[model samples]
Target chain A: MLSLSSQFPILVAIAPLMTAPICALFRGKAAPWAITTIASAFAFYISLQLLLTVASSGPISYELGGWAPPWGIEYVVDLLSGFMLVLISGVSTGVLLFARESITKEVPTSQLGLFFAAYLLALTGMLGICITGDAFNVFVFLEIMSLSSYALIAMGERTDRRALTAAFQYLIIGTVGATFYLIGVGLIYMMTGTLNIADIAARFPEIEGTRPILAAVGFIVIGLAIKLALFPFHVWLPNGYTYAPSIITAFFAGTATKVSVYLLIRYIFTVFGVDYSFEGLELTDILLPLAVLGFLSMSAVAIYQSNLKRLLAYSSVAQIGYIILGLALANETGLTASIVHIFNHAIVKTGLFLSVGCMFFVVGSTYLKDLEGIGRRMPITTFGFVLGGLGLIGVPLTPGFISKWYLVVAALEKGSVIGYGIVALLMISSLLAVIYIWRVVEVAYFREMPEGTVKEEAPISLLVPTWLFILGSFYFGIETSFNVGIAKAAAAFLMGGA
Target chain B: MSFGFFNYWVFIILLMIGLYTVMSRSNLVKKMIGLSLFQISVFLFYISMGKVSGGTAPIVVDGPLDTAAPIYSNPLPHVLILTAIVVGIATTALGLSLVVRIRESFGTIDEEEILEMKDGA
Candidate 1:
C-alpha cells in the first residue's frame, strides 16, 4: 500500500479531477458549487501535505504504475512546485468560496453545473502541469487545461456574445503555442532519447552543443511565452479576460499564466540547465530587453483602457514581465525575486480582479465611466481595491514592494551600467503603475455620480472573500518568512545548478 | 546521412503552410482547419522520428534464447503521438463548436465582420 504521504502529489491533482464529472452531472448552482469547493479544498489540503513533506525531507518523486523513470511517467514535487501548488490550490479554494453567486448571475442556471465542472477540471490540468516530471506529460495536461478554458470562456456568451470571438481567438493562438511546444518536445526526444525530464537533463550535458537542442529551446520559449501572454504575443489576454465571466477572470488571473511562468523556470533551469540556456545561448540579452519593453509598454496600454477588466488584463502582462525579468536576471536574488513575485503577484491580482468582480456584481458594468463615484457606493470593496492597488504599486509594506526590492537589489548586485539602467527602467514602470491605479481611485472616489445613481455595498459573500485575498497579501507582506524562505531556497537550488 | 533530415524539411513546410492559413485567413472555420493542420504536422514529426532504416514492426518475432538481435522501430514516439493526435482532435472539436456559437450569436463567421461589430459595440 502507498503511504498517504507518498500519494499526496498525485492526490493533489486527482481530487479535483474525480469530482469534476460528478459536478457536471448535477443540476442548479448549490450542488455543483459544493462539489467544486469540496474538491478544491481537498486539493488544497493535499498541496499543504506536499509542502510540509518537501519542506522537511526535500523533494519527492513518484513513479506512475510502479514503473521506473526513463520509461514510465514521474511526478516530482520540490520546494518550487510545492510553493506554487499551495498558491494555486489555496487561491482557487478561496475563489470558490464566494464565486457561486457571481457565477449564477453571469451564467445561465442550467449551465452552472458545467461551468463549475470546467473550473475544477482546469484546476486539475494546472496542478498536473505543476507536478509532472516528464516533458510530454506537460503537453497533455496543457491541452486539457486549454480545452476547458476555451469552454469556460465561451460560456460567458450569456453575459456577452463577444466572448465567442475571444474564446476562438484564444483557441487558435493557444493551439499554435501547444503544438510548437510539442514539436520542441519531439526534437528533445530525438536528441536525448528519453522522455523523463531528469533523464534528459542527465543526457543533455553530453549532447549540449547542437543545432537541434538550440532550436528546441527557441521553440519552447516562444511557445510558453505565447501561452503566458507575454507582450507582443499577448493579443488574446485583454479581450479574453475582459469578456469572460468575472469569476473566471479572477481565477485565471491568479493561476494560469503563473503556471506557465513556473513551466518556463523549470524547463530553463532544470531541464536545459542554466549555463546552457543563459550563458551559452545569451538568452538573458534577448529576454531582458523584452521584459523591459513589456513592462513599460503594457502599463502604458493599461492606463488607456476604458474597461476595468481589460485594464487589469493588460497589467497582468506587465506583471508577467516582472516575473520574466527576474528569471532573465539569472542570479540567486533574481530567481528568488521571480519565485516570490509569482506568489505575491498571484494574490495581488486575484484581490484586484475579485474587487472588479464585486463591482460587476453591483454596478452591472465595469467600464470606467460607469464606475464614476463607486468608491462611495461600495466603500469596503473600494478599500480592498485600494489595498490591492497599493500592492501593485510596490508601496511600502505591501508584498509588491518586497518583490520589487529584491529585483532592484538583484540588478544593483550586478553593478554594471546595463544593470543600473534596468534599475531605472523598473522604477519608471512602478511610477507608471501609480498613474493607472490613481486614475481608478480618482474616478471612483472623487468623480461625481450621475444624477440618478444609487449607492450601496456589495454583498457580504463577495466582500468577505475579496477581503481575505487583500488581507493575505498584507499578511505575507508583513511576515516574509514563509514565502521568502522557500523562494530563497529555490533560487539557491537553481543558481547552484547553473 | 545524405537525406537523413528530409523529414524535418517536410515538417517545416507543412507547419509554415498551416501557420500562414491561420494568420492570413479571416474565416473562423478556416482558422480552425489551420490549427488542426499545424497540430497534424507535429504528429507527423513525432511519428517520423520513430522510423528505423532497416527495422520492421516493433512487435517481437518468435525468438530463441539470446540469438541474433532483431531490429525494431522505436515504439514510444508512436505512443506519444497517439495521445497528441487525440488532443488535436479535441482541440479541433472545441474550436469548431466555439465557431458554431459565434455564428449563432453574431450571424456571421467572418473574423473581420465580427471584430467590426465588436468595435462598433
Candidate 2:
C-alpha cells in the first residue's frame, strides 16, 4: 500500500469530496452531521500534517496520476498553501461542530443532508483551489466553490426570502468574476502555450511587456478584485453574508473571500511575479488608493448598520481592504502582514459570527434592538464577541494588533510621505473599526435586558466552538511563532521567487 | 485586418452584448441568457485559439503506413472548453432555478420590482 503521507496533498481535498455524496445519501439527521464533521476533521488533520511537513522538509509537489508537471495536473504545497489549507480546514471543522445544533434551527430536517453535502462540496472546492498548481484548475475549483456557496446561501430562504435574491445577485456577480478570470487565463494560455502556473511563470521572461499580457493582467486583477470584494465590487457581499444561514455566514465569513485572496496572491506573486505586477504594470498605484479608500469607506458604512450580521458583513469588506493594503505596500513585511491577517481575521471574524449565531439561537434575531443587554443573558457568548471586537479594533494582545503592527512597520520602511500617509489611514481605519464594534458592545452591555426575558444562554454546542475560535485567536496573538513565522517565511519565499 | 482575426472581433461584440444585457436588463431570465451568451462567447474564443490553419480534427486513423503524420488541431482547448461548457450549463441551471424560486416568493423576477418589494417590506 502507498504510504498515507505520500498522498497528503490529494487527501486534504479528497477527504471531503469523497464524503459529500455519502453525506447527502444519508437522509437521517445525525448521520449527515456526523459524516461531515468527521470528513472535515480528517481534512483538517491532513492539512496540519501537510503544513508541518512542508515547513520542515520544504515544498512538496505531487504529480497527479503519476504524470510529471507541465503535462499533467500537479498539486504543490508550499508554506503559503499549507498555511491556508490548515486555516481553511481547521475553521471548517470548527464551524461544523456548531453546525449540528445551529443548522437544525434554521434549515428543515429534510434538507439537513443536502445542506451538509453542499458544505462538503464547498470545502472540497476551497481545498482544491489551494492545492491545485494549474491556472484552469483554479477556475474550475472556483466555480465549484462559488456554485456550492450560492446554493448554501439560498438555503437560508426558510429563514428569510431575501436569501433568494441575495444568492441570485451573488451568482451573477460571481459568475462574471469567474468568467473574467477565465478570459485572463485563456489569454495567458494563448500566449504561453501552457496551463501550468510554474510553466507560465518560466515563459514570462521571454514575452514580457506584450500587449496581450498587459490586457491579461488587467482582466485578472479586476476579476480577483471583484472576488476579493475590495470596496467598489463589494455590492453583493453584505447582503449575501447578512441573509445566509447563521452557520453558513460564520463558515463563509472565515473561508470564502480569503480563498479568493489566496488566488489573487498566487497570481500576483507566483504566476506574474512582483516586478511585472507592481513595477511594470504599476498595480500598486491603483491598489494602494483603492485599498485606502475601501477600508475607510466600508468601515464608515459599517458604523451605521443596525442589523448586527449586516454590520459584521460590512466590517468584513473593510478588513479585506486591510489585506489588500498590505499587498499594495509591495514589501516582504507588508506581504507577511497580509498573509498573517488572513489567518487572524478569519479566526476572529468566524468567532464573532459564531457568537452572533449563538445570540440568534437564543434571541432568534441579530438586530441591535434584539441584542439589547445580551451580555447579561448570554454573558459567555457576548464576552466572546467583545474580545473579537477588540481584536478587530487592533487592540494590543490581539491578532489584529499583530497584523496592523507589521503593516505599519512595512509602511515606515518606505520612509516617504505617502507611506506615512498610509500609516495614518490605517490608524483612522482602526478607529472606525472600534466605532462599529463598539456599537454592538454598547447595545449588548449598557442597555438593560428586556423585561420578563430570562437569562438563557445558547446551547453548549454552539458556545464551545465560538469560544474555541475566540481563545484560539488570542493564543495565536501571544504565540506569534506559528502564524507570524509561517507568514514571514511565505513572504520571503515569494520575494525570492520573484 | 485579415479574416484570421474575424473570430476575435465576433468575440468582442458578443462579449459586449452579453455584458450589457446582464447589466441593463432587470428580468432574471434574460440575465441568465446573457450569462450564457457571455460564457458561449468565451467558449468560441477558446475553440478559435485551438484552430490550426489547414489542419484536420485531432484523430489518428488505423492506416499507419509510410505517409507523414497529418497536421491536427490542438485538442487541449477543446477539452478545456468542454469542461467550461459543463460549468456554464450548471451555472445557467442554478441561475434559472433561483429565478423560479424568486418568482414563487416575490411574485416577480424583475429586479426593480423585487427591490421595491424589499424596500416596502
Candidate 3:
C-alpha cells in the first residue's frame, strides 16, 4: 500500500482535479454536487493530516514524478503552506456544502456539472499553487485559478446579466496581472537558471542589487498586488464579487485573495529575502501609506453602497488592507498578526457572505431595501450575520479582536508616533465597519416586514455550514493556542528569512 | 545593453503595442487579440532567451557523455516556453468564448457602451 504521508502533498491537489472531470461527466442534479463534496472533503482531510505531519516532522518535501529539487519540480509543505492548504481546502468544503441550493438557483441546470467542475478546478489551482515549491509552476496554477474563476463568475448570468460584464472586466485585469507576473518570473529564471523557490532564495543574496532583480521584485509585487486587489489596483474586485453567484463570491471572498496574500508573503520572504526585497528597497515605506489609504478609503466607500454584496466586497478590500498592514511592519509580531488574520478573516468573511447568500436565496434580492425586515423571518441567519458582524467590528472574544490586538501590539512595538497613528486608524476603520454592518442590522430588525413577505429560513443544508463558520470565528476568538501556535512558528520561520 | 540585444528590443516594442491596444481598444474581441499579442511577445522573449550563438539543437547527437562538450542551446527555456504557450492558448480560447457570450447578452462588445447600459439600468 502507498503510504499516506509520502503521497499527502500531491494527493491534496490531484484528488480534487481528478474528480472534477468525473463531476463534469455526471448528468443528475445530486451526483455532481455529491462528487464535489466527497472530493473536497477528501482533500480537506488530507490537508489536515498533512498539517499534522508537518507539525510533527518539521516539513515534508516530495519530489514529483521521482525527480529531485533544483532540477525537477518539488512540492514543499512547510508550516506556512500547510496552514494555507488546510484553510483553502477547509473553506472549499464549507462553501461546497452551501453551494448546492444557491448554485441550482443561480446557474442553469444543463451547465450544473460543468459549474461544479470549474469550482473544483479553482480549488485545485489554489491548493496546487500553495503546495508547489517552483515559481513558474505557481504562474501556471495562477492562470488555471484565474481562468476557472472567470468561467464561474460568467455562469452567474441566469440570475443577473451584469455577470457577463463583470467576468469580462475581471478577465482583462486578471490577464494583465498574470502577464506581469510572467515577466517577473521570466526575469528571475533568466538571472538564476532555476525555478525552485528555495533554490532562488538561497541564491538571492549573492546578486541582491542587480537591476534585473530590482525590476523583478517591482514587477512581481505589482502583479500580485493587482491580483490581491490592493489599493488603486482593486477596480476589478467589487463588480466581480457583487455580480458573481453568491457561492462564488463567498468562496472568492474567503479564499482567493487570502491565497494571493499568502503567495505575496511567500515570494517576498522566500523567493527574495527581506534584506533584499524589504530593506534594500525600503518596501515598508511604500506599503505603509498604500495600506493605510486602502483600508480607510475603502471602508468609507463601503458605507454608502446599497447592494449588500457590493458593500461587503468593499469591506473585504479594507480588511485585506489590514492583512498588508501587518506585513508592512516587517517584524515577527506583525507577520504573526498577518498570518493569524488570514485564518480569522477567512472564517469571518466566509460566514458573512454565506449568510448574505442565504438572504439572497430567501428574498430573491440582496439589496438593502429588499432586506427591510428579514431579521424577524430568518432569525437564525440574522443572528449568524450579527455574530460575523461583531467579529468584523472586533468585539472582544471574537477572532477579529484577536487579529486587531496583535496588529496594535505590533505597532506599539515600533515605539513611534506613526505606529500610534496606525492604531488610531485601525480603530476608525472598525467604526466604519459598525456603520455599514449596523445599517443592515437596523434595516433588518427595525423596519416592518416588507408588506407581503413569507416567514421562512434558509434550508438546513445552508444554515449548517453558515453556523459552523460563524461558530468557528467565535471558537478561534475564545481559544488561541492552536491558531497562534501555528502562526507564530510560520512567522518565526519567515522572520528568520525563509 | 549591446547591439546583440536586438530581439529583446523588438520584444519590448511588441509588448508595448500589445499593452497599448489592450488599454485603448473598447471592442471585446480586439482586447482578447491584444492579450494574445502581449502573450505572444512574451513567448518570443522566452524563445530568444534560449538561444546560444553558435549552438544548433539541444539533441544529444554525439551520444550521451561524449568527450567533447557540444555547443547545444539551453533546453530548459524551451520547455518553460512550451508550457507558457499552452497557457496563453487556453487564455485566448477562454477570452474569446467569454466575448461570444458577452456579445450575446449586451448586443454589443464595446466596453463603454456596456457600462452605459449598466448605468442606465
Which parts of model 1 have CA positions greater than 4 angstroms off?
B118-121
lDDT of 1 at A190: 93
Q: Can you give the lDDT of residue A277 in candidate 3?
A: 63
Candidate 1 residue B79 Cα shift, in angstroms, is 0.4
CA deviation > 4 Å runs, candidate 3: B63-67, B118-121
- Give lDDT tens digits, candidate 3, residues A1-498: 677668989999999999989999988688899999999999999999999999998989999998989898999999999999999999999999998777888887888899999999999999999999999999988988999999998887877888888888888889888888988898898898889999998888887789888888888999999999999889889998988999999899989988889999998888787776677888899888889999999999999999999999999999999999999998889999999999999999999999999999988898999899889989999999999999999999999999999999999998689999999999999999999999999999999997777889999989999999999999999998878889999999998956
> What tens digits encode model 2's per-residue C-alpha lDDT throughout A240-339?
9998999899989999999999998998998889998888888889998888899999999999999999999999999999899898889999999999
- DockQ winner: 1
Across residues A138-257, which tens digit of lDDT does each residue of candidate 1 receive?
A: 999898899999898887788788888888889899999988899889889999999899899889988887988988999999999999988789998888899999889889999999
DockQ (model 3, Cα): 0.61
**lDDT for residue A17 in candidate 1, whole number 0-100:** 89
- Which ranges in model 2 have alpha carbons more than 4 Å from their true place? B62-66, B118-121
iRMSD, per candidate, in listed order: 1.9, 1.9, 2.1
Q: Which pairs clash inside model 3?
A: none
DockQ for candidate 2: 0.64
CA shift of A494, model 1, Å: 1.5
